[model samples]
Target chain A: MQVCKKCLLNDNMPSVRINEDGLCNLCSTQYESRGIVNNNEEEISSLIKANREEKYQIILAYSGGKDSTYSLKMIKERYDASILAVTFDNGFLSDTCLKNIRTVTDNLDVDSIIIKYPAKKIIRAFKYIEDGKFFPRQSMERASAICNMCIMLIKNLIYYEAIIRRIPIICFGWTPGQVMTSKPLIKLNYTMVLKGFENIKNIITSRFGARYEKYFLDDAFMRENEANMPYLYYPFVKNNYKEDSVIEEIKEIGWIPPQNTDGNSSNCLLNSYANQCHVSKFGYHPYAFEISNLIREGYLTREEGLTKIGNVANPCSYKMICEQFEKITG
Target chain B: MNIQAVNEKLKEFFENNFLYGESFDDINGDESLIDKGYVDSIGIISLVAFIENAIGIKVYDSEIVPENFDSINSIYAYLKKKMNTQDKAV
Candidate 1:
């Protein structure tokens, strides 16, 4: 298969068109707009100062991963936003992740909320998606079905907290590749949002027995926050990430890389399982595009990017996936 | 230019940039991009930006609903109306 000369993306990936010059469609399109942009420091500080009336200015979706750990450190040290770190413990999180979470939050003196829904609840959602694609083809190319569901769940839960606490910003530490946008904040069109979220909510309603459908957001939540929609922030997108620098910098905050995860992940074991399913189903890694983008934008070396996607997922994660989803197989 | 030309251009952009399937000819212009899984949450945002940059019609947040932006045909119709209004105002 032909691969892009500029980045590591190959023709095997869906929606990829490799040019005669040996550049992939994604690389060609981004070539003109590629530049380093770490320009949101002032904006974040101003928002935090202005929104002091709210208990917390930002509710950062902390995944206890290296990227997020770096983001947490930057927010506290660089921007110094009044922040509350929130994590949804998607049952497959490494034990090391929990330790990192506790140590980092305690050291930073930031309050935190760690929500662990019953594993049965998350497993049903996983099984439901096994039957069909639950997201757009583009989104599916970016991440696995299981990872998509987990991210949606985390966003919904963090958004809920932001609305309740009157926080002005809901933050995530998405890398430039993961974010796919250079914008500092994501302006969510409500109609577009509901359209995106409706299916995930339905998955939850069906699996959680419809009785607790209220667990998902309803019109009441929308009505209450109409005038004050919390701004969805991707702070990490503004920073030009160098992966090694990020890992080394975040280590001072007690963040340790977990040995249990596959090469693609630092915190969640399910990520390995998800990558396995994605490759088997799609013929290429789910992160093929994102990793290529990282290489294109100089966040990682091509060799480093290749190594990240080359290694197979953790074997133990396959066993964990079987144990979790077997509950719903009947 | 006419709405047909505008539509052809939009289709070309999506085909060259984002479409995962074989050809735009197979897609019904009236089909909802969101409902059909052609575009997701972030994809919709990118679409709006493309519309603004391509046609100079700035879409506001309230106008991002299904009626105007759900399908390629709907986007065409909205563009026609908007361009007509802009011409009249001028």
Candidate 2:
């Protein structure tokens, strides 16, 4: 268990570099060279001003997950924007997560909405996902591909909601580990949407079938809505902190754990299985890249980060996930 | 470029970038690169860029679609089709 000297990432993270001075590469290159120190209140003020100028009635993509929950907290307490916290309500939200969602939002007074996808379709998709029926195992394996689609469908639905509401910004709590940020945020342009949709089509068709092209594809609409709606991140700063300390600080703002879970998960029960599947298949989780980046940034120690991943092997949680799979199929 | 030259270029480009060790003899144009696990999302972006650069024909932002760029063969056909239409317009 090794921790980076600077950032919030641990050694279990992949694709990290520690310089001779033990500085994380991300912090050294992106932060120091760009000179975008988090303490520069002027930049924060400008970011807030730019966000306000967009006339953004934000639709925060909430999942009762920890990151999203924390993101919502930041929106209200920090930015003070007009934010609507919306969850996809994927038919399997733990009662604990639902409760925490209520707790956090009520405390912050952010408007909340939960839209449920058709349960049977979600189940069928996950069944195939867990059963490993998808093809072209290059981009994703069975478990991850299914999870990615679940998130993708939710993202599209959120976009539609944004269009109807005339909301410009669709804020997601995606940290760098989950996504790559060539630009911190940019408006969803037509070309980007077309390219993204095309890539997604290849992913689905190769794995599911050509029949899904009509159902899953949405190039036409995304292209039509191509306007400048920048996706922003706050965690791009504050990469240097211990997990417990960060969680403790956020808890002060009324963020609490969902019921029936431990530190490894703050939202979904299925995550442990997802992490396990990734580790078993690729010898690491897909999340390894970002975590490694965080470590390289000197935000976390390798020891602490490895501890977080080590918790991915809780037997009770693993059994519960397996049991749920059986119950759904039976 | 002649059709044969276009096909040869695609084969060479894929071998160099995809590095899958599969030769032109192994892959037919119509077979789905995605379906056969020969390419992934990153590969799709790279291939689209490669086609644009090599053929000197721009794939308009709108023309990006699964049907148009599903495989190396399909991509070649797409470029050829677009080239013909452009020539007619000219």
Best of the candidates, TM-score = 1
Per-residue lDDT for A208 in model 2?
57
Find the candidate with the highest lDDT and give its number.
1
Write down the worst ten-residue block by lDDT for model 2 chain A: A31-40
C-alpha RMSD of each candidate structure in angstroms:
3.7, 9.4
Candidate 2 docking classification? incorrect
Task: Give a tens-digit lDDT track for model 1, residues B1-90.
Answer: 566766776776687556874587787989988778887777776676566555455565566677887787888788888777763210
List lDDT for all candidates, in order.
0.76, 0.58
Candidate 1 lDDT for residue A49: 89
- In model 1, the runs with Cα more than 4 Å from the true position are A34-43, A203-208, A327-330, B1-9, B48-68, B74-90
- Lowest lDDT 10-residue stretch of candidate 1 chain B: B81-90
lDDT of 1 by residue, A1-330 (tens): 888888877777778889998888767764233332344566667778899787889889999999888888887887656889999998888999999999989888888889998777677777777523767777887788888878888877887788888898888888877866535665565555567778767766865677546556675677667766677777677676988899898788788999989988989988877888888887788787788878876888888988999965988877877776775555
Clashes by residue pair, model 1: none
Assign candidate 1 its CAPRI class.
Answer: acceptable
| Model 1 share of native interface contacts | 0.40
